[model samples]
Target: MHPHDKGKDRLRKFVARSEPAHPKLPLVHSTDAYTFTDALEDGNLEPRDCDVFIGEALIYTFYGRPSYRPNMNESATSLDHYLPVCLILKLSFAQDLKRIFPFDTGAFANDYYSTFMHRRMGLGDFALEADLDTPGRVITTFFGSARNYLHAAPDTKTQFDPAQFEARSYAALIDAKNSNAMDSRGSGIEIQIADPISISNWVEAAVVPSTFVQSETGDALRRLNIEILPYNVHSRMKPNEYMSTVTDACLTYYAQKGML
Candidate 1:
């Protein structure tokens, strides 16, 4: 067998015996209310220009909570100024889509900051140049939030080997305990979906702040037949603070797993 085939076979066996992380968790895509309203009007969630992944829509599998907040420290003129709308999508929605992939950390940071800096430095395409297959990306979901196990180097400061697919797969499967180490609110783990995701059949609900319930956007949301769940954003951790907490959690998880 070819060396690459051997690696894939090993990954297959590893995945067969691995415990999958929160497979049933509702994936949340947080956006500004204006964007959410536009999606509702269009009957689909269109991909925005992401600095890392280019033309892809991002969703966070943050266990049961929303992981994104836009300018949490800044006061908004209205609830909609910050990313106040959370579109909850079923995990199974991927089954109906093409080119859905999972990443252990935010894809842009994973590649731009850690993996292919040269590309970001005007040497090549800004998008990740990793030759990652869909199956390998799928395996990442099994070890979601356990960021350390999903990379050749655990520390974000270190450069990552884009070709070390087998190593990452092996590392994740070897430590099943960290598969669900998702206590941090901002786990930074994300899923990238191909552009123009039709949300009419996929999104289960839209969660927004209670103040938005009577807003114009709320009326528009109700017209779309999507359940609008009112949530308290003030009770949640600030996004900037969550960044620090996420870094600490990653280090703590790595230490607990003896990978630090």
Candidate 2:
């Protein structure tokens, strides 16, 4: 069969079938049915706050080539709604800072600092110019999704409608900072998401879960330790302006050493 036709058939099947409920997922409600804490209890604000503050949080989220919208309920906000397979890598600030921040402040400021702070609300001295070469235990939600073979909605623009497809998971940890470990394998995973039809079934068969344990390297990524400020929730500022506000807030808070 032609690849395009094959993908369409697979997409049709996915739409027709029923996906088993993820046990960890609670029943979601509409926006009118929720309040501020409702979003918090659902694990959006805290992790996101950590992502912003941690200076080195890296995201590995999935999206269709055109556009991919994940499963959403009424309780979801544009800020928090995400597909099931999204992963954010959180590192240990205390233990791994030395190794992870192998690049000096000069390299960071010139090459990465302002750009990351401006875009993703964090800083990573790690070499992303090619592949992730820094070593640290990255705790992320993907650890759970990978184990479950989570489902993600494909792009609607590609003639694939509201069908969900399997999403595989993989993780690699290189113990050496700035090592050419990934040069051989070419960044480990092939992430060129194209037509969901061709790869939907492939995702189901490619579930390779990252293991978690409380080793001396520190505990596996389980919980994030940051909280979103009130302003981050209801800010009228534009994206850049809002980030500036957040950056100022972060700077002041750090300068105060938690006094604020």
Best by TM-score: 1
Off by over 4 Å in 1: 1-23, 55-65, 71-79, 91-188, 233-260
lDDT, candidates in the order shown: 0.44, 0.21
Worst 10 residues of 1 by lDDT: 123-132
Candidate 2 ranges beyond 4 A from true positions: 1-228, 232-236, 258-260
For residue 202, give model 2's deviation from the true position in Å: 34
Residue 59 deviation, candidate 1, in Å? 7.0
| TM-score of candidate 1 to 2 decimals | 0.51
Per-residue lDDT of model 1, residues 23-125, tens digit only: 2344457666666777777878876655544454543333233444545565434334454566766545653322222233442243423332233222121
Per residue, candidate 2 scores C-alpha lDDT tens digits across 31-150 of: 111221233344331212112223332212221110111232223333422212212112111111111121222222333223222232222212221212211111111222211212
